[model samples]
Target: MDFYGIDTAPIVGVEPTDLPVIDVNDSRMDFVFLLEDDSYLHIEFQTTFKISDLERFKLYDAALYDQKKRRIYTYVVYGADINEAEEFLDHGSIQYRAHAIYMKGYDGDVIFDRLAKKIHNRETLTDEEQLQLIFLPLMHTKKEREELATDVVELAHQIEDENQRFRLIGATVGIGDKFLADSYIKKCWRC
Candidate 1:
């Protein structure tokens, strides 16, 4: 949320409800949370663009609304460049919309360089810095997934606190898996 400058209060995870929409077939959301104000925040990460993805977001939004009866804010974060900034689904009386965040808008090299400097100086990473580091791989496409994963893992290890290191590693592996190989990600974790 901070990455995109969206202000959010403290949030807690919300278990997904089984609201069966058509053709959903046990599909799960990427991440869902309950905000402090009792609204639902749903986020989906996509490596590539697909028209069906928008429909899935709509279904998730409808499900959340049906179960919680609260406002739902949904966003799709795309790892690849997208020409469109927003997606809208309108069917006569029904309308659904989601904001699109393009990862290419961020510069991974700048983020990595700042993090490396902080690590070199033995500075504790702020909460936002930690998050930026975890998401660094999505920002730039200069290197292959293996190379980027290796670099992120190396930076994650530089965290002085074991717990923070492990947490960052977990996030990196989880998100990096979309681009990196499982074996390579596992090796990075073991490191």
Candidate 2:
């Protein structure tokens, strides 16, 4: 995918059966998709920093590997800023890790302005831009998320293709939920 430079073609909608089973109250994975090359792409969205998350990822990796017999690539997209950079877990010979995409690392205003300019010029958004818009809610301060989500939703509506618009809206809501209130996110979705 353009957002993470994933080169393999995706096998959309393919679900893994052997992911770790949990009790009634245990948390599950955020997102999982199988790639055409038999690799599993795992994505997790985090709004709060937790040490237990890394342990969860390790379990996910083990279960995914058990089911698919292919390599698993995991990524964590953080909504809030975290000072720690512990993206890996190592216990002697065994190790588990995830690629971290810290939203705070990006300049939200620059990305938002670029998207706005494209929308203003009546130009269709490219795939990369669409991905950027989806993650825009996390790319800025908590105070700026609502405003950016509004603008991103507005621009998303301007996209002519109904399918693309819908997908963008869905992705926006998924990521926006971490930063924006439910009501505001619903309004953006209805835009």
Of the candidates shown, which would achieve the greatest TM-score relative to the real structure?
Answer: 1
TM-score (all chains, Cα) for each model: 0.82, 0.79
Task: Give Cα distance to truth, residue 15, candidate 1, Å.
Answer: 5.3
Off by over 4 Å in 1: 12-26, 188-191
For model 1, how does the per-residue alpha-carbon lDDT over 73-165 read when each residue is reduced to its tens digit? 887777745545557888889898877777787778878888999988989999889878877777755776557767988888888999999
What are the Cα lDDT values of the candidates? 0.76, 0.73
- Put down candidate 2 lDDT per residue, 1-191, tens digits, no spaces: 65655455665664543344532233467778888777888887776667687777778778777756988888888864654556888888988888777777777788888887887787888878887888877785545667777667777888778898888887787666666678877776566
Residue 28 alpha-carbon offset, candidate 2, angstroms = 3.7
Clashing pairs in 2: none
